[model samples]
Target: MKAADLFEFPASIPFADFFRADALPWQWIGQIKKALASGFETNVPGSIPPGVRISGEVYIHPSVELPAFCSIEGPAWIGEGAQIRPGAYIRGNVIIGAGSVVGNSCEYKNCLLLEDVQTPHFSYIGDSVLGNGSHLGAGVILSNLRLDQKPVKALVDGKSVDTGLRKFGALVGDQAEVGCNAVLNPGSILGKRSLVGPLTPFKGTLGPNKLLVSKPETSIQER
Candidate 1:
């Protein structure tokens, strides 16, 4: 699906030009690196925490709330008013949009987080795109790679479409909600405002405004 269908890239974020609205959602994953490479000044706040370790070409707006203990690697951007909670691990090619929460004990890499997105507890977000206002409940994992380590394929229109990347994660659409402890399999696509019930192991594409529940028999219904 098109990135525009899922996210409206915020104007507050300087890298918006790197991500085109008409491009495929997964294609934006690769643009993360290119966005960081385009060059922006590194502007981390002067008040440094002893437990916080930041290295490489990183930009943290002065308004960002830094935790006492976190590891932030290079080629990353943390937007204004973002909260970086304790024990968060932010690796390369990551973008945290304004007012987003990079939650405690969460690991993020190669991802784009739009405005106000929250991954507020133990979650692994890699090679993915989180749209504006989307929230991930505690312990959610966006599994990026297949066990066989082949290119990830997305289920679009009930057919498999090759993504051509070995490490591709979920594309969480705008305002989507993923419940606690849910595992989103590789190349999963959650449409705008969709919800996945807690502890569900979900794959394939979920249409907009749908709710996927894992009962004795898994079922999808309008939210």
Candidate 2:
């Protein structure tokens, strides 16, 4: 499938021209940081509002609602109407699209969140791309690196395909719903509108419109 097929960019949240390059979705994964740097120099959407603690050259839109005490490093951009709650830490090389939320006590780095996406509450998103309207439930962790610190890989066409990046996280498609406390291992890809059960440990790829449920059988003996 094409990169456009994978990333659902809507009117409310549109990705910059960096994604317009003629490349596949997987090929662009490792190049996100460079793309962000280049975009920061050439074209950044908006301005950083006051009352936010900015350590680096962050580009935040005027319409964004950034609460006080939110820490933002440079090479990052937040779009219009985005909500970054207090204590939300945004590291460098990140792009948060319009109408998104990075809630309190959450941390995200080197990630892209499309418009209307919700990653609210106690989550960690790194080196990943979240599609439009996608919602990551509270306490979800998108694992960006493996234990061995080797290059991350994905299950594509039933084979392990190298992502060529030491730290690569999941690519969640549009409107996908991940339940609370889900752990998305390195190179996980959740297709459009898919549902991941609560507390699921997910790795590899889940196709579009599917339901992944984990029900552990429990014996009800004498209480």
**Per-candidate count of clashing residue pairs (backbone under 3 Å):** 0, 0
Best by lDDT: 1
Q: Can you tell me which runs of candidate 2 are displaced by over 4 Å?
A: 10-15, 39-51, 217-223
lDDT, candidate 2, at 116: 87
Reference-based lDDT, residue 72, model 1:
96
**Residue range 1-223, candidate 2, lDDT tens digits:** 4456567555543345567535556555655577666645323334444656776666777676667667888778788788889889998878888889988889988888888889999999998889888999999999999999999988877888887889888888888888999899998888788888788888988887877867673121211
Sliding window of 10 residues with minimal summed lDDT for model 1: 213-222
Off by over 4 Å in 1: none
Name the best candidate (by TM-score).
1
Q: How much is the lDDT of residue 4 in candidate 2?
A: 68
> What value does the lDDT take at residue 169 in candidate 2?
84
- Give lDDT tens digits, candidate 1, residues 1-223: 7889888999989988899999988999999999999999898778889999999999999888788999999889999899999999998899999999999999999999999999999999999999999999999999999999999999888999999989999999999999999999999999999999999999899999999989767899998
